[model samples]
Target chain A: MQTKETIVCRCEDITLEEIKSLIDQGYRTIDEIKRVIRAGMGPCQGRTCRMLIAQELAKYYGIPVGEVLMPTFRPTVRPVKLGTFAGGE
Target chain B: MPKVKETEILIVGGGPAGLSAASAAANLGASVLVLERDEKPGGQLIKQTHKFFGSKKQYAGDRGYQIGDLLIEQCGNNPKVEVWTNTTALGIYEDGVVTAEGRAKHLKINPKKIIVATGASEKMITFPNNDLPGIYGAGAVQTLMNVHGIVPGRRVLMIGAGNIGLIVSYQLMQAGVEIAAIIEAAPTIGGYLVHASKIRRAGVPILTSHTITEAYGNESVEGAIICKLDEGWQPVSGSEQDLKVDVICLAVGLSPLTELCFQADCQMKYVSELSGHVPVRNEHLETTRPGLYVAGDVSGVEEASSAMVEGRLAGISAACSLGYGEDIAPKLQAEALAELSELRAGPAGQKTLRGIMNLMDKGGAVC
Candidate 1:
């Protein structure tokens, strides 16, 4: 059987129909959609796509929209050169 | 007289956003240079193996590292783009100048336009024994397992049920580590139900409304004491439960690395909604300081896709400011704005958009 193709957020690589199907299956949380679709798992760490998914999921669940759990930041928030991180002096 | 190296655009990050910006600018025949801090070009992408979601333009359905490889290839194919690995951009100066020191040489460049696609880092909470040897950040664990062929610990106690916590828990399991349980301070799981369910079906109990009050063990993490919390995030009495574990992983949140922007005297505002104090920039991603632009998480914590869009806009804006071209500015801006609008269309983005709008309405720096 051919898998249905759906693009969620072009930015984060999430699918549109995949998200809709997941919501139909009762996966209501934005976090749920992220795992299934890898919505906010990109390098931007879902900075852009996460909110879009959260709103979509909220609407699908028929509940008041809520905040999606954002990923935590690490040190050297900017991509630091390994040489810089290792103290290239 | 003096060696004058010239590039139309300087991108100061090799992550997804930075690379995308470079490709976008190079596609338009602009000279672009990408400086990455890591030994390898791909930032965070090297460790991510899962497929992406979104449009074909975003390269949806591909792994992050694969996308990075494609960007590297694209950069190679285009002579206009130059990538300098193992290089760190120390500061952004006035007039679009970027100061840097790499493994072999110290250099200064005054690119007409620059894009600061510096990404955000992982955030960890500090408890009494947080500094223990075995205690690691969730990202650290990922790097250890995904990047390097090593395991952080045999048994782990993951704190925070958000995506990082849940996904890392599953990864740890995949790496053959025993997960005691996933503990979260919030009343609900912060990550996706699919991730939680993946772990749940694998028999990992997710203890929501609970937190790691303290990590036990002197030398390393021998155990951790978890407890239920009230709605206000305070621990409840007599609900403490101790579990034997060897490692404690923190996946709390992230804060923008605006030290460079702050040092350069860019106007900043502290909005809890956007993670922390970020540079106050207009729609073009230009900071209050002329010629200084911010993108990726440094602007406001968002995903790589938005970062890429923001980075492209910032690059084009900087290039146009430098007389590269102005005809494509409106077209590029509209496309980027559209992509940005789509990314922020969901509920999770509401508060962040509100934060930005509030900052924009404030009309200047918060502090």
Candidate 2:
């Protein structure tokens, strides 16, 4: 696999190589990766990429996929316009 | 302040589980409000064209969509149940106010009890060029071909031999599309033999212990590279096979849609047997937080049959908590529990049974 070109986070356009390099640097967990590369900080809010990242981390750490703690899910589950929340039309 | 609508019971999602819950709660004389994100209330059932298999109570031998229609009709006829379509639940606040956006307006709902039957989302697998066009989740393919009259593509490579994969392959054939092959990473097929037999009889090859290494395409899916896996699940070198296909459909399983459950601070546990992380709830389907209940895939991924039973159990339990149907709720709850156990008695139900037991053992409320 061409890790350099293969995309992992579609929303942020992060690559597999970027994620792997971060893991090697000891930046583990989806939340840490998200803070550094904005992987899960997009509009979809990690709906598509979090699990993939979890699987990658699990493979690297030799742990069960479920043992990888999932990132915290905040409110406004789906994206809503700022105006909608501020009582604007 | 946004318009605040009050109801005795609030059910999130209007699929088979939510609709059954709405009917069950309404039958117990509770005013129920159901919120559905889509334009319609059937959820996944709207795209299923094949006949369902189950006991008669679950509408066995009836087509999937027809069963959906019946459940919709039941909810529609009940005066105490109100369904809001195209409404998405945005958040569950600490103060017990649920916010939703729909129909060009944002509103807040205050209900005495809440039942989350939000269902699950399709799981995705990573490979080269997986983000290219012409790649779709199995549900999206069904929506394209079954819901709309448009065919997805001329030929397709299907990943995962689960029931969704096999059934969608048959549905694609019925829509005049060619299936290149159906592949499963596991050595044995995951779906029912009946569904597998139908596609097998149609001359489509079912390959087990195989997986796609990469999708070949510049812009859209033009082909795929598949290879066999060894005992360790590593792809064998020099065993690669290339196939010509336009569409790649992934039916590789699903994870529960539990964003709201997490937001509400319900106790959650990761049970891989149930697919992914799920809320820890009691036999009555009530989560750790009182008045917040879960049914269907929101609690744990299971069949539509068990989802309906869980919905009914959650519905009656929630209504009974709100001081409705006290005389008959116990009987109905017991019946629902019995039906659920019976549905989980087959060999196929072993994984789900184990998942449920794990949840129970890990401090799920006994009720």
Candidate 3:
């Protein structure tokens, strides 16, 4: 139960305690948590932590995990250099 | 703008599904281009060393990697199929222009029909210290040991009793590593009894209704704490057990990697039965967006056998839409559908069948 130190978002080093506290403080959605705590903004782009966060939110609200709306996935799904988009080889 | 490369059918993610699609479409005289993000053409199939289960048409008795090789060979031999490795499909535009990043350059491909066989990603569970260096997804462990010949750890604690968990545990033992125990949150083992018995005979206990609570390590995984779960799935008090383990392997489940479908503005429905959010598609596997299709895990998480069948179905369907294989397309399509229904007729395929029904029942834009 030492959740205060249990890391949830490995990229941003956010902890489970931080996520739960955010849920308790009315930050219920994964997108909201990402905006506030930078959970899904890392290079991995939430591949690892988004679902984990969604599960937490679903648990707190006593709702099914699928009911939670996943955040929008933007273009260039993988991280690419600006030059790549500029047609540079 | 650089001149956009054009093809009749473009398949993304050259895994079992993508390669199969490429072959199916190319055999029908459609110019097929496959974009694979990895260095090699085979997707997860390359790392799976276990023999597959299914009808003989799917190469059931052959090892998974061998089947992958067969699919790759078929595509390679077909002059109509062009596979580009180390090329990542960045996005699917509304205008039907697919942009991708090749080994050293950005390339835009204009294909008349697109097949999104991007596959799925492993699901993770929530537990304290789960992010330690030694902890990894089951697929990652397979990749390290089977593909690269590097053992992950000396002692491993596998979480989940699904087929992947059991198979990976057996594979780990094959690589001369010791498994502490295999734990499952479910009350009963979820994988085939055959796989379960293989590891059980090896003396690795399968602890059902048990879950890992925390991993103990500073720089990496050194140990873990597991406990029995109650009917409500909450950890039972006073049932915690500590075990010395160097690696924690998670084989919880997989969610379809549908980011490309979402980017393409395809209508998506979250079917838990499918394992996660999936794009709504029809019997032919074409998505809400015309000229766009999804095969394999991107449609729903299922066995590789089913993924291959789905790939063939989507490939022929996409090719048919492009006016290729006019005379033989219907018969091939029907055969693929029958084979799919047969694959789903077993007890294991019921969940996938239900998931597909849920998606198709709520009809989307006609392709």
| Candidate 1 docking class | incorrect
Tens-place lDDT per residue, model 1, B107-167, is 5777866677777777655354555568887878888899997998888999989777887
List fnat, each candidate: 0.00, 0.48, 0.58
Tens digit per residue, CA lDDT, model 2, B266-356 = 8888898898889888889999988999999888888898888898899999999989999999999999999988898987789899998
Residue runs of model 2 more than 4 Å from their true location after superposition: A1-4
**lDDT per residue (tens digit) for residues B1-367 in model 3:** 6789998999999999999899999899899999999988889899999999889998898998999999999998999999999999988887889999996688999999999999998987777787888999998999999989999989999999988999999999999999999999999998889999999999999999999988988788889999999999999999999999999999999989898898888899988789888999878898888889999998999889988989999999999898899899999989999999989997778888888788777745353
Q: How good is the docking of model 3, by CAPRI class?
A: medium
RMSD of each: 14.6, 1.6, 1.8
Model 3: per-residue Cα lDDT over A24-70, one tens digit each: 99997888899999997887678778888988888899998878878
Docking class of 2: medium
Best by TM-score: 2
Instruction: State the iRMSD of every prediction, in order shown.
Output: 16.2, 2.7, 2.8
Residue B152 lDDT (model 1): 88
Off by over 4 Å in 3: A1-4, B363-367
Question: What is residue B362's positional error in candidate 1, in angstroms?
Answer: 1.7
Error of 2 at B163 (Å): 0.2
Clashing pairs in 2: none
